[model samples]
Target: IGLSFVPDLKLANSLYALGSCYNTIALIYTKLSDHLRALEFHHNALAISKRIDNRRSVAQSYNNIANIYQDLEDYDSAMVYYERSLALKTEGNDRAGMASTLNNMGELMLATNRLNEAEKFFLESLEIKSESGNRAGEVYTQNNLARLALLKKDFPGAEQYLDITERTAQELGLLDELRVNYELRIALLKELNRPADAFRYSELLMVVKDSLMNREKAEALAGIQIAYEVSERDRQIAFLEKEGELRKSQLALRNTLIVVSLIILGLVYLQFRREHRNKEQIKTLLREMYHRFKNNLQLLSSVLSLSARELTDEQALQAVRSSESRVNAMALIHRKLFERKDEARSINLRDYITELITYLIHAYGYHERGIQTDLSLEPVQVDIDKAIPLGLIINELISNAFKHAFIDHQSPCLTVGSKLEEKATLNIEIRDNGVGMRPPAERRGESFGLKLVNMLMNELRGKYEVSTQSGTRYVLIIPL
Candidate 1:
């Protein structure tokens, strides 16, 4: 009758009704364990449901197909269909269907011996079922939980779950569920060493089994074989006819798709070329900007130097020279960035420090003063943001040591070393073999260079320690 109506149906509602009828037939075949026949009916139902945009029926079809695959022990295929059904069911907010799918997933997990995952699914299903007031679903979920508890050797937990399931099944007069509950009770009793109780439950199970078989046998035996054969032949003919129509439609769609695809491909190629050219232009612009910035900084340093030559006061000359050193430090960073091929914001600290120290020695006439410098720098890169502050700190400390620390000494020695400490921190130590720093009370006056070092250290989010034993030693630690 459903097939007869399919030909006359022009409305979506009629098509949906026809799809539901086919789905019912598929479910009946599934229950009868005729998976191939079930598949044919399910496919037909799915086709009609999708055509009418009936999401609920589409989800049902996916679930029914998954059940057939699960029964056939094709777990991977079953999982795929199950996931599809779950997604659609969730989208439609079908609470009961979600609970059912969750229960099915739990059963599959139990079969695979994934007891923990099985329990999780069962509990989730139970929550949904209980919220929806589905006592039957709750009973089913309770039974699954009992089975999981039994596998985990939690006899008391299993007993607790089984008790609830058994009571509910008996209250609802769900004979099929009662049989399952009795069987579980038998297993539990045997595990508990209660042979008499086990035997009693076994007898109960057998009685329920006989009663269920008798009730189902008459209904299952009613010309089912002939009906199944006839339906199978009809399904095959309908499938071939549908396939022919689908092929014709697909050919027409393919021609249209090919032309659209070629146009899209051409647009994508043009966009890619445009983006590639834009990126190259951006890189060139960045390089030019860095270059111009470096030149400007150099020009500023030269202006400061020329101003220092014209200065009469020693204090004014020292300030000018200090400003020039800072300008040069910043210029060197921009110069390194411009020279580097890789577009990284960080500069190699080892190379930067080496060059800066060399320039400082020459600027201070320290090399002519017979001051020997030893560099023990480790290979480390620091970002420009932190590097500038670190460079300034080094400049202040080295300049202070070169000017004052070697005043009485004939031969002055300065050592700058860096090392990577634990926790990805960079540790720098600058030591000078000369007179040590004055006592805290004596050095109470705020020295501009030391204050600047402290300010820069704070900016870098780092800490520094100064020791005045034998010689002045400055230790700095900064995170990477």
Candidate 2:
């Protein structure tokens, strides 16, 4: 019919109608999963629409072509066409077309496992659909949202969206949307641990599936019979006209192998993407855990600080302050781990130790007492297992120096240094040029801070030496 009116190019309205007819046929082929035929017809419609400068028809054609590409798993091509369709629709101020295209794009994003982008597209599409009173489109988009919520394990949100979709779809008499609502409800119920409810939905889903499948199977069987009969007549004609049976068989085998290979490659790609996404999710969760842990530690330290302020006894005040400093040290390490996006387990000693020393200096009011500080730190990454213990040890050593060594000293100097001796040994030194203390062997019993330091050292399986020659110097040796 379109070819019959081809010569009358001046009949633009007739040309537009012909374009619509071709586009309708393309959509029919698309539903039948004949993507190549669908694409060919869509292009014909696009060319005719473009020649007549009909933006609406052209946009429709582009969207249809994009849908076909999406079905074929050609995501890059689908995106390109979708963008073109959206641009044309926007220029024409076609709200309905734009909403449909956005919904299609959201579906594509969802299929590619881009949950955030999919949600954005779906929400925008839903808003447009609702504003235009497109209840069927609204139901479909809400169903998609329910599926997305299920994927994200938002059971309550999924249930809410599913309820809306179910009610609207039933009222609208949209069987396709109702079927999807049932499917999503079952999945949502299963996720929420409502197995009895899930079983009910499962039965409804099967009933819907059977009803839809029966109609589809009847249509498909009729089509297949007609196609087979036509092909059989053609095959007979070909067999009589040509003798290339072996060549045809070989060609068919080659095509089958190519298709199998493509399918295998696609599966491999999908698996790799899945693993990569899982790893990214794990990293995000780990960082969040570290952030929360750091925050809780800060809160605990603050409580300790408040408690210390209320303590009248000097010894009680000292104990609370000591606990606060220890908590602060662990919190600082967690802060560093959270800052580091690449790896969560290890932290840079340079920043970690520098910030820790600064916090300790202010905490003890050593700056007001004219205490001089020297720090020579090496850049090193240590695992959290060792870093936490090492941090506490440093906190205890420094706090001990500020309390005992710097008493009644005119010019008190605190020096801290760290070096990587050899490839596998970490050496740390904390020295205070103030009043010296007794030797480790001469000391009768250990303080709480000293006990903590000793326990941490034992945990790290490291060695430490103390020298009271000039003032008080402690050297710690840890294995990498």
Candidate 3:
């Protein structure tokens, strides 16, 4: 604030340095438990960091923001920032930074209900730290790993990590870490039924905590007092140190943003070149995926195509065709998701179902088969955790109707409707008017596909109901 009106300051450099200063102030405020103030400064830092062209700095800014969000228990925002940090770390080949990002990501996952995924991420990060010989980071990850194991009730695993952490902390003379380790060791011992050892370690941990707190308060107080005599010179020195720290962050941010912006901007110029190159790579990958999907479809199709090949009896061919339509229905959903965006997870069900219906119509080529999709939503998005299995379930019901209900010159038409019943519950309905089941037990309630759908529905904790009014109507409601 005192230097705010420094008329001679270079705008770009000062703006950059100002951001760094804000970051340092934020860090100090954070340790003081003044998170709101810390966040304010961090926001200031981000504002300036974004003004410059520095990818690394932009990433660092994101990390700082994430750290605050995490402290606030805003895990979703924390994970987002952590991912942004990871992307930047990858682009810059910042191994240490990457490890830190991974650690943070794992921590966020652990906070959520993703225990197994959290463990995997934590272990992956631990490996990275160990390989890079970043012992401090290893200690941190180990501490978290130990905590997670304890939460999971794996006392032995928790103890193993705590023992490793203690050794590393001792080597580094990190008293705070040692204090935390002692606390954990005591807890682990208690959990393991070693009462005497737990009691002993608990006493030691208390002693360590008291000593560490005393030492920290004493050192900080003494350091403050010592500066009093040389206050004028020390004030200048403090200003310089603060300025230096700020300048470093500013320069780092500027350099990073500039470099990144240039690289991204340059890519725009080489769009044709990059796309030309990427086109080949994308085609190779997509073509490979298409071939794999086609192969699987072909295998099922071959079993059904037996009549043409004159290899199997009519009954067998009919069974094969039933299986083929079901497989194709599932395949159509996959094709919708894959052909649109990412393939690993999640998709827009409405669009996917729409595309699927189009494919089904073209395949069956039934002129009277008018398909109407009534979605109680503009678009329905669901993760593959629920979507893939649910999609398959829908496919089975629709295919069964296509093969059995609307059969032998029957007017075959199906209506598929999906919507959210609540914030967490999704409702899907498949109805056909061609033919309704006379009795629920007519199908004998047995088939691999139906069994799979039942198992998945059970796993997803959903309720499925089947009814025959004018036609067959199957209703499924799944909790997210």
Top candidate when judged by TM-score against the true structure:
1
At residue 1, candidate 2 shows an lDDT of 26
Candidate 3 Cα outliers beyond 4 Å, as residue runs: 1-13, 222-231, 234-480
Query: Can you write out model 2's per-residue Cα lDDT over 413-439, one digit (the tens) per residue?
Result: 989999999968999999998778886
User: How many Å off is the CA of 322 in candidate 1?
Assistant: 0.7
RMSD for all candidates, in order, please. Answer: 25.9, 23.2, 21.0
Cα distance off (Å), candidate 2, residue 93:
66
Candidate 1 deviant stretches above 4 angstroms = 1-263, 278-282
Question: Model 3 compared with the native: what TM-score?
Answer: 0.46
Which regions of candidate 2 deviate over 4 angstroms? 1-270, 439-444
Pitting candidate 2 against candidate 3, the one with the higher TM-score is 3
Check candidate 3 and list the clashing pairs.
Answer: 53-257, 53-258, 54-256, 54-257, 54-258, 55-256, 55-257
| Candidate closer to the true structure by lDDT (higher is better), 1 or 3 | 1
